[model samples]
Target: MKKLLTMFFTFLKIGAFTFGGGYAMIPLIEVEVVNKQHWIDKEEFLDIIVISQTFPGALAVNSSIFIGYKIGGVVGALLALAGVVVPSFFIIIIIAYFFLQFRNNLIVDLVFKGISSAVPMLILVAVISLSKSLKKELSTVLMILLTVIAISVLDIHPVLIIILSGIYGAVFLRKKVN
Candidate 1:
């Protein structure tokens, strides 16, 4: 019960203070979950990040659920997810209320422009972080290259790319356990 409360509060703090979404939350989560709380090791935490992206939800939400489950099972997952979402939900509602009022302000416009400029750098950092975490398997590397080329050069749908990659992995990289 105490551990669940701690997990909830920690994730709540993470969700509330973070801005610019999941990428911005990474460094903060690393400090809290890995360095401070010791809930998970660095490599395992990073692995969570990688696996979370393949899921359908936001990265932060998925990460919180996984960490919560790791710490204290299903009830912990519920608590952590509630902690992560509730603050953001209220904050977004508050912001949405005022955004219409300030939409035309020059300062607001400039701030939004500045944020847009930073988005690409944030995405690049996310890529770099994931790349550092990736195991250096030949098939994984080839799939990464193929996915990049397919998206960038061929303009293929990412779903199709992922599907093809999965087929390739199944056909060629299946492990044989004795």
Candidate 2:
């Protein structure tokens, strides 16, 4: 029960303070779940991040579900989910109620523009942090390069890229027995 409450409050704080969504939450999640609590190691956290990105939902929510389940089973998952969602849900509700009235206000528009500009920097921080964990192998480097090209230049769907990368890794990157 105590663990469950801790998980809930941890995720609640994460959701309440984070502004740029999932990617922006990665470093904070790592600090709390890995460094602070020692719930999972860094590799496991990276795996969770990969899994979260591969799935359809928001990365932060997916990560919370995975971590919560790992720690406290089904009930914990629910508590964590609720904790992460509730703050955003209420905040969005309040914002929506006021936003309609202030839709044309220049100050609000400028504030939104400032936030939009900062979001990319937050995502970049996440990317850099994640990259530091990557193995310095040729295949890993190539995969990263290919993925970037696929997403930025080819405009390929991320799901398809993930699928193809998985297949490529399995077939070509797998180690052989002596």
Candidate 3:
């Protein structure tokens, strides 16, 4: 019970404080789960991140479910899911209710602008942090570049790209699972 509560509160703090959605939460989650708590190693955390990104739901929610299940089984997953979702649900509700009243306020606009500006950096930090775990192989680089081109230039569907990439990784770029 105590461990479950700890998981819940940890995720709750992460959800409450992070501003830019799942990508932004990556670093904070990494710090808490991998670096601080030592609940999982970096490699497993990265694998979970990859799996979370591949799935349909919000990355943060998916990550919480995976990590929570790892720690304390089904009950932990529910607690963690609830903890991570509760703060955002309430915050969004409050913001939706009050946004109209202060929509045009200069301070509000400035604050939003500030937050928006920081969001990109948060995402970048996540990218950089995750990239550290990626193998620095030429094939990996080429795959990344090609994927970017396929999505950006050819207007390929991301889902298709993801499926193809998964196939490619499974067939050719297989890693020795530890």
Summarize candidate 1's per-residue lDDT along 102-170 as a digit string, tens digits.
989999899879887875676676677657766788866878888889999999998787677767767
lDDT of 1 at 22: 80
Cα error, candidate 1, residue 27 (Å)? 3.6
The 0-to-1 C-alpha lDDT of every candidate, in the order given, reads 0.84, 0.90, 0.93
Q: How many clashes in each structure? A: 0, 0, 0
Writing each residue's lDDT as its tens digit, candidate 3 over 1-178 gives 8888989999999999999889999999999999988989988999999999999999999999999999999998999899899999999999999999999999999998999899999999998988899899899899989999999999999999999999998888666442
Any residue pairs clashing in model 2, and if so which? none
Inter-residue clash pairs, candidate 1:
none
Candidate 2, superposed: residue stretches over 4 Å from native: 176-178
The digit string of per-residue lDDT tens for model 2 on 7-110 reads: 99999999998888899899889888999989899889999999988888999999999999999999988888998899999999999999889999999899
| C-alpha lDDT of residue 29 in model 3 | 96
Q: Rank candidates, TM-score, best first.
A: 3, 2, 1
Two-way TM-score contest, 1 vs 3, winner: 3
Instruction: Quantify how close model 3 is to the true structure by its C-alpha RMSD in Å.
Output: 1.7
